[model samples]
Target: MEIDYSHIKVIGFDADDTLWVNETYFREAEEEVGKLLSHYETPNKIDQELYKMELKNLGTYGYGVKGFVLSMIELAVELSNGKVSNSIISDILNIGKRMLNKPIELLEGVEEVLKTLSKDYRLILATKGDLLDQERKLEKSGLIDYFHHIEVLSEKQEYNYSRLLKHLDIKPSEFLMVGNSLKSDILPLINIGSEAIHVPFHTTWQHEKVSENETNGVDYKTVYSLLEILKFFKNN
Candidate 1:
C-alpha cells in the first residue's frame, strides 16, 4: 500500500460528519420530536421505529430532513394508531425545515486544514444528501470557497466513487477520499483503487457510524483528528 502522495491529484471529502458537526444537530432535533411523541409511545420505541424507517427511506429517498421528517410522521401515525392527525405530520415537516435552517458549525480546525489542503490538492466535496439542503449548508458554512468542485449525491456506493472520478476526468488510482464514515466514505473509494483517510468523530448518527473492522483494505488508516492528516502526509 505504497502511496506517492504526489500522485494524488484530486481529493474528495465527505461533508456532514467529516467537515462539520452535522449529526449532533440532527440528533437534537430528533430528540425533541421523540419527547413530543413520548406520551403516545416510549422514547426508545419512537427512536427505534423512526430509525428503521430512516434507514430504509435513505435507500429509496436519500439523506436530508425530508426522509427523516416523513419517517417521524409515519412512526407517529403508527404509534398513535391512526389518532395522529395531518397537523402532526405538517408540524414535523415544519420542524425538519427549521432544523435545516439552523446555524452551521464547522468542526475544530476544519477551516485551517481546508485552507492548507486547498493549496496542494485538487479538493472536491463528495457528500451525499438532499441537494438543496446540502447546498444551503455549504453556502452558510463559509468553507465552500476552498473546494474546487462539490458533489451532492444520493449515496456513496462504489459506483458513486467511479462516477465522481470520471466526472472529474481523473483515474481512480489518482484520487483520495477523506471522510468520517468508514462505511460510506472510506471503503467505497478503496474498493475502486483510491486511497482513503479516516478522521473519526465522537457523536456520529447511528446510521453514519461504522465499526473499525469495516475498513476493507490494508491501505486504510484512521486519525483521531483532521489536523493529524497533515502530519501523516508530511511524514509519508
Candidate 2:
C-alpha cells in the first residue's frame, strides 16, 4: 500500500531517539542502577523490578530522568527491605545527573533532514518528557531554529494528538509525525487519522513497545534511517 505525503503541511518530530541519543542513556543508567542494587537482587531481577517501579510511579512523576531516579531509589528501598544504604541512593541520584547533563548527539542527517523539510513544510517538535529537560535538550541541540513550535507532551495518545492538531489549527490529514517508538509516535497519530513514519532506534524502552497485533493492520511507513524519509517528500 502506498501512503501519500502530498497533503502533509506540518511535520512533527519526536525529540528523543528519533532526532538524537536518548533511550541509550536510560539503558546505561538502568545498567548502573542494576549494579548498584545487586546486593539486594540479581541484575535481571533488579531490572525487572525497576521497570515495574517506574510504571507504578509514572502518574506521580510523569516522565524523564528525575522520575526514573526516584523509581530507582524507591525500588532500592523496597528490594532491600528499606535497608538500602544512603551512599547507594546517592549513586542513583548521580546517575540521573549524568544522564541529564550528557551532551546531545544528533542522529545521522538529522539537521539536514530538518533543514530540508522545514523549507517546504511547517516543522514542529512534539515530544513527551520533563518540560525543563526537553527544553534544555532542544536548546543544546542547535536544531531549535528549524522548528516553528515545540511541545512537550505528558503522554502521546490519540486524544493528545487530536488536541494538539486542534490547538495548532491543523487538520488531522495535514499533520505527519516522525519518531522511533511505535506506541507513542506511530500508533497514536495513526489512530487520530494523521500520518506517521517510524524510524526505529537500536534500543527501545519496554513501555514504548507495541505488540504485533497492535500494528497488524495499521497504515504507516517505517524507514530504516531518518534520512530515508526525504525520499517521500517532493521538495527533497
Candidate 3:
C-alpha cells in the first residue's frame, strides 16, 4: 500500500499496548475480580456489573488502576448488599497495587523505531491515563530520551488533539499520530486534519473499541505491528 510522510514533522505514539503489554494485565485483573466476587453472582454477571460501574464512574474518576479498584470496591458492596468482607476488599486493592508494579515490557522494535524516528522527526509520547502512572511507565521504558514532549491526556478527542497541537505550535497537516486504538488514536486526528496510523494491539479496552460506521469514509492506514512504520520514511 502507498503512504505519505512528506509533510509530517511531529509524530505521536500511544503508550500501554501500543508500546508495551497493558490490556493483557487488565484482563487478568478482571478475571480475578470475578473470582473474588463469585459468591455473590456468576462470573459473567460480575463482569457486566463491573463494566457498568466503570462507565458510570469514568467521568468521576477518569482512567487508571485507581479508578478501576474503586469501581471494584463499589461493585462488591452493591452486589453483596454491603456484606462483602474486608478481606475481599483488601484482595481487590492488592490487585491494583500489583498492576501498578508491573514491569514495562516493550513491544518488538519499539526502541529501534523510536531511535530511528527521533533522528528525522520530533516524537511525542501522547497517551491517556493517570499522570503519575504514565510517567512511571515512560521512565521505566527507558525510551524517554527519544521524545520531545509527553502528553498524558484525560481523553482523546478532536478538541483535545486540536488544543495539543496548538500548544505545541504545530499545524494539523504536519502532525502524524500512530497508536493502537481507532477510537482514541486514529479517527480524532483524522477529524482534525492531522494524519494517523492504526497499529492494533491484540487486546483493546471495551471503551476504546470503535464501530465500522464511525470509520466509514475517514482516511487512515492500519499496520499489523509498530515497527512496520519505518518503511514509510525516506531514510530508514
Q: In angstroms, how far off is 171's CA in candidate 1?
A: 1.4
- TM-score list, all predictions: 0.91, 0.98, 0.98
Give per-residue CA lDDT, model 3, range 154-222, as digits (tens). Answer: 999999999999999999999999999999999999999999999999888899999989999999988
Error of 3 at 230 (Å): 0.4
> What is the C-alpha lDDT profile of model 2 across 124-177, one tens digit per residue?
999998999999999999999999999999999998889989999999988999
Per-candidate clash tally: 0, 0, 0
Strongest candidate by TM-score: 3
Q: Report the error of model 1 at residue 61, Å.
A: 2.4
- All candidates' lDDT scores? 0.82, 0.93, 0.93
Cα error, residue 49 of model 3, in Å, equals: 0.7
Ranking by TM-score: 3, 2, 1
**Distance from true position, residue 111, model 1, in Å?**
1.3
Off by over 4 Å in 3: none
Worst 10 residues of 3 by lDDT: 227-236
